[model samples]
Target: MKYCYYILSVSLLILIFSCDDKVDLEQFIDDSEELTLVYSSISPQDTILKVRVLKTLSSDNNIEINNSDAFVIPNAVITLSDATNNSVRLSYNSDDKNYQIEATQLEILPGATYFLSVMVDQREFTSSCTIPNNAVTELAFELTDNLNNAGDLKESVTIRFLDIPEASNNYIVGARIEDDAFDLFLDFENRRFITDQIEDGALLASFGFFNNNPDSVTDITLQVANVEPILYDSLFASYSNKENRQNPFYEVIIPPNNIEGENAYGVFAGFQITERLITYQ
Candidate 1:
């Protein structure tokens, strides 16, 4: 597909904070309970499934403290089964902390139901959802015809959504781009940075880059997650008010485009309960 070009300016700033004066507290604290796995492909209609695991801080009475050392279930074994019960095992990538069932592992026919079974730390978690028939989302990137006084490419690209509701308050957003000729998932914390409220029935944002050669964009894809009804409503207010200035999101710089050909990008968006979402409800 041919990419589009646009010109815009985007600026990023880093803020730091500090606290003083401490109160005495207990030296020992109990660890939080293991997170329960909530499995589903980011898009129910696609064979390329994305799964998420989460646990609430208040779920277990024995677990009282906040946060845990283990963000991801290590060495977890995950399997995906189609409507016919044919299954395939997903490989766990420690660096990304996700059990990825590649597109080649299973052929997802439109309208088929897929089940995901996860085993981590001796606990079993299972869930299933149907994939939608339409395309999950599309991403495009291009260089602006405009140039700075120094003759550098001054351009920005806005990844847009199709068939996504503009009034939808509940969603998680993510994106993946081609790196080293392979699709590398962007870190969750970093992807959160690009996230913002979808106002007036549409979600729109822009990212600016400086380059002498505008032909360097290999690929870009944006993904949106499902927001549970309750959590979705809360975000409508929180994001609208901007109560927290902290950008839980992250931005990664992709080195000049080294990949070639109609390079493809993937967006992984899913619905899973998070501690914040659970507690707020």
Candidate 2:
């Protein structure tokens, strides 16, 4: 697949890295209780929101992604409650093999807290998460047509956007490029979740580089998502674990989960997305 690029400012990088905590290994304890294994996330833009009820994993905690039935919970009753306190009972979609309800039936809004409950075999699991407010404005980007170091056609970029003001808010940022036949996503090793505590709510700038194919991009987009704490912490820790896998001194960090139930495990959360797109000129 073809590739696209974006850059994080050097000063921002320094500030972000400075938050690297000195984790004391021996002082850490595993007092946290494990809960139910279910997956669910809601967004205003979704046509159909789905909640997957998963089976318990093996002793080694290994999951087989391709085996649908091995992990799917049978006869689970799932319900979603919106901000207005209206609850909807989701139906199991045989096609998708998951519990779902149409987004139109339940209007979800940013800054609203929602609750998810699942019942399986007389046991009930529940969790609640707040959708963060979309505080980021439209991302401003300047693109230049160019040939990358690989001699392929590419576009270079300079991007700017406003920071989310709340320190509790952790946002995920990424870029994507698309053509009619294919789309490419961007990820950086140096950056994953960004929260600017030092210059919260201030305008921030970033720079970039990319590789090109199909000669040019048909469209490009910037995705900024502000998410709640458990979801943000879970994703942030997962990203760090992936990046540090090659280092000998690396310690694996478990992603924080919010689901609550006996003999269950997993997290349920929501996302508020802000996206801006630009077509090739």
Per lDDT, the best of the predicted structures is: 2
What is the C-alpha lDDT profile of model 2 across 145-227, one tens digit per residue? 54544585555665677876665566666566665554334433235466676676877654345433534566667666666
- Backbone clashes in model 1, listed as residue pairs: 44-131, 45-131, 45-132, 166-201, 166-202, 172-225, 190-250, 192-249, 193-249, 193-250
Put down candidate 1 lDDT per residue, 1-281, tens digits, no spaces.
Answer: 22221111001000000011111111111323322434233333334454444333332234323223233345667787888878898776665445666666777654466666667566665655544343325444333344444575555333334334543334444443434543233222222333235444354433333222324435544444443333233323323223233445633222121111122111112232111110000
TM-score per candidate, chains pooled:
0.42, 0.72
Give each model's whole-structure lDDT: 0.38, 0.61
Best by TM-score: 2
- Which stretch of 10 consecutive residues in model 1 shows the poorest summed lDDT? 9-18
Q: Name the lDDT value of residue 272 in candidate 2.
A: 66
Candidate 2 local Cα displacement, residue 188, angstroms: 3.3
Give Cα distance to truth, residue 159, candidate 1, Å: 5.3
Evaluate residue 234 in candidate 1 and report its C-alpha lDDT on the 0 to 100 scale: 33
Over 4 Å off, model 1: 1-33, 37-69, 136-281
Q: Least accurate stretch of 10 residues (summed lDDT) in model 2?
A: 6-15
